[model samples]
Target: MTVLHEKLRGKDTGYWIIQCTNPLTHKRTTIRRNPKTDAKFKTKRSAQEFELQFLKSSMDLNMKFSGLFEDYCNYLEVHKSGKSLIDMKSRYNRFFVHLKNKKIVNIRESDMNLIVRDMQSNGYHSSYINTIITTMKILMNFAVKKGYINNNPIANYPKLKVAKTNDDLKFWTPEQMKQVIESIPEVYKTAPDVRQIQHIIRFGYFTGMRYGEIRALRWKDIDFNNNIININNHISKHNTERAGRKNGDYHQLVMDDDTRAVLTEIYENHKKQPEFTNDCYVFHSATRGPYFPLAATTGNKYMMKLAEANGLKHITFHGLRHSHASYLISIVGLSEAEVADRLGDTVAVTSKTYAKFFNQARVRAANKISSHKLGF
Candidate 1:
């Protein structure tokens, strides 16, 4: 009943194994079946029927690797955020291309390893290569759960090592940020995009919200009386869809007078627009409708142009969040937990990321202590 005439056994042989779970003990078991005859089936459907009879289970064996990928994509669309779904599709597309026409049970760790090496040789960053490998591992695990493959082919696959340094985490100085924001109006004139970019930059600097969070802002999310911003929605990078913020949850932040002022001005202007509505995005494209958000590329490009024009050190739009955190911890004297709350991160992550800035604060305190004796 086997469709594949190729006898594949052991871990090295490229063949798919059927994975099933015991109902009583909840333990997983793998079943490998070989045909009695050397005849190869003409159609994938016949092979599936034969596999079902041999295993005495309803799990279909005719699913191609590509077909399994489509099911995986469907799973992602339901369970994952829009950004994560987009990222997975982009990475898995390359993997599908490499493992074309192969059955899910027929893919081996060696095939995955070859793809990893190829990606490495293509000059991708170590972090990115690791991500690609991780994507494969996730798919294989999904296949196992769906009873297509018995085990994860690259479960033991090693991730490429990524180097880290202080300089790798880029942030703008307070002075540089001020200069860039000030120069935006002069550089871009009276365009609606300039206003949107300015507002996004100011929001990032003061609130430490991620790019997606800021981009997904809606008029209704702003509470003018309470001076609070309800971060309940996020627009994906392509501006094609919306979802919960990066953590798949909502967050709230109290706004300062300056931030409230900026929002007030924008809201008033928004009210004047013909397309303005309660559900309108806070930052929208100049050409697109008012409810639509701007694309990530366009926002980043505008920020970069502003930095270059103002003779300031260039940092991506996300860098503004880091800058906000650094200023809050080092200059505003906020506690690590408070900063973490503002940035939607744990205290440990905030401390580790801004350890250098915290050290500088300690040095300043030491200088003050040495300069003055205790009055007691």
Candidate 2:
């Protein structure tokens, strides 16, 4: 292979030229650089090493810091369709604000440590610190491939050790569930708008659907004949300075009979209304569109009010999902695999996080067997 012509331009003070042929295609290519602006290389051998490094990086999946971050956000936007790019952009902006006026290549391990220390001083928990560090590592790895930096400074940073606090895994008992359902006001039951909201809560307890999935439900995804509810979508709220925007799309999940019944009832009721006959959303607000998934703060506020009114202890709406899973394992005596399948979680997750609930059920079963043996 013949080397391409090398143009030794400038005052021989900073710049150099490299000419070489493509290893596979044998095509000739030339690269020009100003060594002063780049990292220093004294000897010809050192220059050759730098040239090889550049060539390798050019062929690999690398990107400049800004470019890599933008690409990463784009990837998240496409793959995580339920999430909005604007939300990611906000997170990126918050992280970048701390890194202003600093080159991506110059970010050192001490810089990350200082950031964590500052956050800790402001009373942020270690978990939140871990999230920031993980995000930084992802961005750094992307920069490494682009040849912006030779190494990831935060790659080996120690994770914050967090101790387990109170096992606040509270769930509604069968009696409590009955009481809550029976306590629904007659006015809410009669009102078409409020009735569906109540049903949404009940369905969440019965089927363990996430808040986003419940809001995004459509009449088309339900099958009354087969008693199947296809949980392929979620509604996400994109908060802004103005009114928040709501978006929905398909996602993976699990479903059951009670969920289907609640959906069918809601669907049939909506079908009877002339204005809602062709409407696409299952749970629309008074504004003639699907209800935006409630923000975490707003949802928690309403949940607390509901708990207070019903004379129940405060629990998150997400607690309803946990309650359902707990009931399946404890009262229903379902295996971990069965519970995991119904709850749309892996068996490992079911066993690791929820296995303790099953222990109580097992003890109860053993006691019953012992009583039979003793003829009592």
Candidate 3:
């Protein structure tokens, strides 16, 4: 039911106020306007028509934003990797800190724009801000599918532009990579876990496997008979637990003799352990006894300390993957498609990412052309 009240603002001024009960919240919401400036009823009949229209619009309510957000997080736990779920939980926590239990139906594009503008004003990078915005849009779409909202208000929200730079795309030269690997302190190299770190660095350089895939490698994945290594699962960095690789499919690549020998050496060392089994992690932790895969920070921290000590260029573990790509194209003379297959990437992506290396290859091929001319 809607009720209208005539209130006297002053001796001569009066305003029309309409109050309607919200079905979802069970609270009354009031709308008031000065009768002279707006709401010129014209007649009792016309005023009743306008009052009905306004009350219907005001009383409509959708699900609460906080309630829907919880539902989305619950879904993520089952369907997403633990690390990804943690990242989303963090991003959403920052978002709800600002929005604070607003109704999903009442959220507007302008509100989203304001949030983005606020992030930009605070000096956050465009890419990070864009990721937050993308997460919000994902939640809103989920709400729509659940029939909480009629449509996504910010579905087409614009993403902020970020500048591109080669620093992010940097890859180590083969000489630099060799120097860095050789520079690991000899004392650390003798330690059991440090030996595994040494193996991981070299394996990343030769194989180009992502950090997750490399850490998740097991004894069973090594096909010594076929001279190939299988990449079937990955460990999420946040919880240090196994999950399917990023591509969610099994990948296999043949190893060169040097890589095979390195794996064999590690395997032989592990076989000395009476408790070692085929299911054990290839790079087991040292301090945590045996069979536990090294924590995600182990390789990253090792590379950082080694680079600082050796005065070499600071490159993370992923840099080792990029170094492998560069080595294959520039030195090994492998074709783009072949390199892509080895790296578990599509050919188009390989070509796009290593366009400079491909161009150099083209120049090398052109140099072999003879100057002899034939009549057409």
Candidate 4:
């Protein structure tokens, strides 16, 4: 192996010579009278120590903020599961664009605070701000671990406070649900676009599956004998592309008789169409290759029309999932934990958000007890 040495000069005319070998080329290089020489040592032991410290600092300085961010995104793609990689990529890309010119070490708590405050001031919700902050923190932490920075600026940053809204907990009553179901046009059951929409609605109510999970459903994931639908994958739209159709990456959800019957009907209908055979999606758009899970705005518009036609108040499609959970807990008498498991929600979230429905159910139960005791 070849070694190289050179002397570097200090601002005050002081200089030190440093020696090191290039690992890749196995070539030796030495620097003499370097600016950092004044802090040098006379003994070989002291020289070795000084060289090690200088090399460590040099390596740290060589780590670029942009490089760290790229590695962080790659880490997310490889290590993070459940969320679509496309979605993660989009979010990270937006964050990177915003932070492109900023140095990782220069990012401070005040900078984050200002960015968060600006977002909030511009009418962005706390949830959205939280997601941005989360992405930023992930990258910053990665930089710290890579020796690019000594500390993570986001470590002590205040979290955005998400305000609860009635929409967040909205659910349809049984009468309202029945009205909407009855009002759906009979032709929708047969028409390709409407059929998919009908099936999506029914599945959401019966299985509490999200829009993405419902769209990603394939014939293979369904186990009719076991009455279960595996939710191992989700269909998400990011960068105008549909993703979430792969293997061993989806979750499983139980299918009740109602949901099974609806799915079976759709499947049978699809099989009759020569073009839309078993190979096609269970719920697909006629125009679009397969339904990309309608955007939130479009889905809301359809939901509003459905509600109005049924003589019911407007409710979003997600309200169907909430209604399913509410019905299970209140009318069906399922425990909170059971409701959580069926809805793919954490027990704590289920209990906190849906506990009010249980309170009402308990009151009704008490009324029944009193009426029975009053025996006229």
Candidate 5:
């Protein structure tokens, strides 16, 4: 801390001078502060405090966007790091290379507008570009909290409106799911990789389990007596074992008759193998033995290949979860809250995602009420 003692308004006062070096440009910066407004100039602690606070808010004036972003990424690494951290670094470096050297305070709306227009012109999906923009907003929000900037510039920009397509509704019915499952030739089932895909897809459809949860599931998680699959952890996209789920909920899916049957079938078959262990992955990796989890991408590619070739709609592994949710809402007539609980999601998300199914449920209720005999 550099303190300057000088005459201010005919009174001798101690002032704080902050020196911030921009890491990106390697340029030296000097910022002087008068402690008269918020701090008593006599105390040394006030000058120190003034220096600290000035670094935060006026930082935007001193540091470039990339330098602040690196600091923000470091902050996130300690607080909330994930596969997304890696993705953000790559994304920003590629697209917003120009923003790297510009001071955080100078990053304006017009600069963002040009980036969006370029991305749109390049055939990038609105949803994908929206995700990129969201990361920027989150970073800018961090800057605001740290006093890097007074307000987030990107916050005011509207997300590119995504057009809804049938591609968005990429789920299958019970019959469709069954057809795709059976479409795997009986001969291919002899291969461990093919069998693993066959079973995992079926599991995803019936249980509404995320690919992460399914890959992370251990043989120990199956409670035969209680008929529940304890979804204790999620394997992140980076293939790391996250202790809790995405929503931070410890979920246990009570197995339906179909789910229980599927679980039992896998256990009965898997128990016979020498590789089987109590703590082994329920959906064990075909290539990596019982210790490692099955790869989601490999399963998706092979599963889609067989299904698409046989005139079945392509339902990727994640689509199986959606298919299950659609089934619960439409076939079983489960409430939004009930579906959300079963799927380890919030009711609001369930309602929004399966809106058409809920609308159909409303129609069914209307028909039932009109046919009722009880009247005044």
Candidate 6:
């Protein structure tokens, strides 16, 4: 039932009355709303949405968000890696705490919008908010599957639109990389204690490896004869070595001249010290333990500081991998399969990620072929 008040006591007044009955339980519910305060519940369209959501949530007192989210986390634990589970648990602690005790049916599109606004206003990136929403939606959809709720009300509401094209990617050009590297103080580049930072940066650009994968590297993992650098594991945020890369399999980066030269420099620097062994981390942080790789934060912090000081564009540590992929696709013009082999993704996945670059390549190819003169 919908009712709109036109007047009260001869003064102009407008408000909405939402009334509904539970089909399953024969329970009556009514909500009176003033458009001035509750914008989400003001219009007839949104009033009906509120009616449906409130009725569903009121019907079942036990379908709580906390309980359902815990169930979802249990499901994720069995499927996701430990590190990934920890990350999600952190998100739960940080952002999802407020939603914990609410009914599953109570979560709404408007609520999600509020969350997006709050996160954005608090300086959270769209990508980071995307992850939070993705995790939340996974729980909501799972609730629907388990019959905990009638349906996910927020299902149709799309996420914050994020730019996905090459122009939006934050990769650095080859020249920018050179400028940032060269701007480093000479002593920082020469001293073994600090040189690891520069070496790690160069190594990441030379071979498109994730910071975790690069940090986890061992001299023994490198096979000079086979021309392969095996990526089999990573150093977790907790400083413990974990097995298997993010892609869930062993990947190899074939050694090109640049990669070989970078490795040669790293090895020469390491062999000068007595602790150097095939078992040692390839990028060791002397400030920490010689046995431990640079804590993921160290490299990231250095990059931020270096960027601020040098007037260089802040290419995130992960952007090094993007730089490598962009260089391979747009500069070297490698096939998708070739890039995938180096990047450790399937060709289809790689093509979708770098679709803008691939599209440009197609245009260039067509133009080059069409330039051939055909005399009639």
Best by TM-score: 1
Clashing pairs in 1: 15-105, 16-105, 16-106
Report the lDDT of model 2 for residue 214: 61
Please, what's the RMSD in Å of model 2?
12.1
| lDDT string, candidate 1, 1-376, tens digits | 1223343556526544444543223456544443566444444455555565643343334556666677777888898778778887777676557675676667787887788788788887788878787888888888777556567777898988886655667788788888888898988896757777788788778788888888788888999889899998887765645656786588888998778888888898899988778899887767887777777777678778987898777788888888988888778878878888887788887788888877787888899898898878
Residue 26 in model 2: shift from native, Å?
Answer: 55
Q: TM-scores across all candidates?
A: 0.63, 0.54, 0.61, 0.54, 0.61, 0.61
Expressed as tens digits, the lDDT of each residue in 108-225 for candidate 6 is: 8877887888999999878889877887788788877655577788777777777666655677788888877786665266655555666777888889898888889999999988
Q: Name the lDDT value of residue 37 in candidate 3.
A: 60
Which pairs of residues collide in model 5? Answer: 56-147, 57-147
Tens-digit lDDT track of model 3 for 1-376? 3555564366424445556555456677765542446654334445455565654344325446766677677788998878777887788777655664687888888888888888888988889888888988998898766545668999999998886443466677889877777766463766656667678888888899998898788999999999989888888876455556776577888999779988999999989989999898888778875677778788788888878777767878888888899899889999999999999889988888788888888887777454444446
Error of 4 at 302 (Å): 2.9
Tell me the deviation in Å of residue 303 in model 3: 3.2
Off by over 4 Å in 3: 1-111, 114-126, 134-167, 186-192, 238-244, 368-376
Model 5 RMSD in angstroms: 9.4
Candidate 2 structure lDDT: 0.64
Query: Deviation in angstroms for 49 in model 1?
Result: 7.7
lDDT of 4 by residue, 1-376 (tens): 1122333345423334556543234456664433555454334455445555554555344444555556666676787754545665677565446655565556778777777877778988789888878877877877666445677878777677786753468778777777666666652555447655666777778877766666656676677889888775665534132444232244567777899899888778766766653346565655665323345344566678787776676778778878888889788988888887787777887778787877887888899898788656
Model 3: clashing residue pairs? none
RMSD values for the candidates in order, in angstroms, are 11.0, 12.1, 12.5, 11.0, 9.4, 15.6
| lDDT of every model, 2 decimals | 0.74, 0.64, 0.76, 0.65, 0.76, 0.75
Q: How close to the true structure is residue 165 of candidate 1, measured as C-alpha lDDT? A: 53
Model 2 pairs in collision: 62-145, 62-146, 63-146, 232-251
- Kindly report which residue stretches of model 4 are placed more than 4 angstroms away from their true locations once superposed: 1-125, 128-158, 161-167, 182-192, 237-254, 275-279, 290-301, 304-315, 374-376
Candidates sorted by lDDT, best first: 5, 3, 6, 1, 4, 2
